[model samples]
Target: WTEHADKKGRVFYWNPASRHSSWQHPLTPSHKALVAAYRRIMQEEDRLAAIQSELEAFQQQVEEEVKGWRQSHAPDGTPYFYKIGTQNTRWDNPRDELMAHMDLRMKMLQELSQMPSLLEEVAPPADVTGLDRTQDSAGLSEAAALTDGPGSPVAP
Candidate 1:
C-alpha cells in the first residue's frame, strides 16, 4: 500500500486494485487506522447523544419557564425578540420578554458546543497509544467479556 498526498494536503492510502486513492478505499494501513479512529469516535458520539438528551431536557425547562413568564406578563407578547441592527442594537420591542430566553438559548448552545470536548476528558490521553487497541473479532469479544455479568467465565 502506498500513501499519497491530495491537493488539499490530506494523506490518503492508494491501492492498485481500486481506482480510488482516498482513505475510504480498501487499503490495509488506512483501514486499520480508520477502524481505530472509529472506535475512539464511538465514545464521543455516545457523549453527543447524551448531550442531545440533556439539551432537550433543558429546552423543555426553558419552554416551561417561558410559558410561566408569558402567563404572568403581557397578554400580547412575542415569543421571539430580536435586535434590528448589524452592530448597534436595541430590543425589538420594549415589552419583549423573550430577550432573556434568547440569552439563555445562546448560553445553552455555547455549553452544548463545549460538551464534546468536555466529554472527551475521560478519553485516554493523547500520548497514550492504543487507546482503543487493535483487536480482531475474537479478541474484542474476549476483552469485552471481562466487563460482563458476574456469571461470565473468566479466562484462566
Candidate 2:
C-alpha cells in the first residue's frame, strides 16, 4: 500500500496480495454482521443519553415556569393584580401539561436505560426465561457466509 498527498488532499493505495498493507480493507460479511450489532448497541446508547439530557433540560424548564408562577401570584395563591378594565388574571397557572410530559419522558428514559440488556423475542418460550440473546443468530450466519472468498457477495 502507498499514500501520497498533494495540494488537493491525502490519498491511499493498496495491493490485495501485499503483506502489511497501508490500507486495511472493508469488513467481511461476518465482521459486518458483528459491526452492525455493535452499531445497534451504540446507537441505542446515544439515544438513551440524549433522552436523559433532554429530561434534565425539561426539569429546568419546569422549575423556571413554576418560579414565575409563584412570583406572579399572591401569598394566598390568588392573583395579586388584574388588568384595569379586562379581567386579566395575574398569577400564571401551574404547567400541568408540561409536568405530565416530563413524567412520561422520565418513564421512557427508564425503559431506554434497560433496552440494551433486554433481548429480542423470537419464538414461544419453553421455560419462560425471557427474551433470547440468540435471536440475532440469523444475522450472524448471514455475515459468516461472506467467507466464501473473492467474487462472492461478501467479498466487497
Candidate 3:
C-alpha cells in the first residue's frame, strides 16, 4: 500500500494489488486483513439486500395475484374470497397459502446458507500425506458393501 494526500490535503491509503483507496490508514498486516474482511462484509450486505429485494417483489406479486378479491362467508359460515368480476372463488386466503410457501422457501434458504460450511468440512485437506489413514487396502468398497448391493447399480 502507498499513502497520498488529496487536493484538500486529506490523507488516504491505496492498495496496488486491489487498486482501491480508502480514507482509513492501512498501515499493518492486520489492517489489510481488516480491508479484506470489510470487502467480505460489503459483499454479504449486498447479497442480503438482493434477497430482501426479491422477497419484496415476491410479496408484491402475491398481492397482485389477490388484487380485487373480496372476502365473504359460505352458507355454513365458512370463510372464502371471490374475485370482483370473475367466476374465481377460493375457500382460503391466498396470502395464507403464499406465506406458508414463503416459510418453506426461507427454510430452504437457511439450509442452503449452511451448505458452504458443510462442503468445507467434507473437503480434502491441502496436505494429502495423512489421507491414507482413511483408506483401505484396495481403497474401495466391496461388492456386498456397495450401497449394500450384490452388484453395481445402473444409472437412472
Q: Clashes per prediction?
A: 0, 2, 0
Model 1, stretches more than 4 Å misplaced?
1-45, 70-123, 126-156
Better of 1 and 2 by TM-score: 2
lDDT of each: 0.46, 0.47, 0.56
Location of the lowest summed lDDT over 10 successive residues in candidate 1: 86-95
Clashing pairs for model 1 are: none
Error of 3 at 59 (Å): 2.0
The collision pairs in model 3 are none
> By summed lDDT, which 10 consecutive residues of candidate 3 come out lowest?
142-151
Candidate 2: segments with Cα more than 4 A from true spot: 1-45, 71-93, 117-156
- Per-residue lDDT tens digits for candidate 1, residues 134-155, read 4686766324333233455455
Candidate 3 lDDT over 84-106, as tens digits, reads 88997776565564555555544
Give me the runs in candidate 3 sitting further than 4 Å from their true place. 1-46, 75-77, 110-156
How close is every model to the real structure, measured as TM-score? 0.27, 0.32, 0.36
TM-score of 1: 0.27
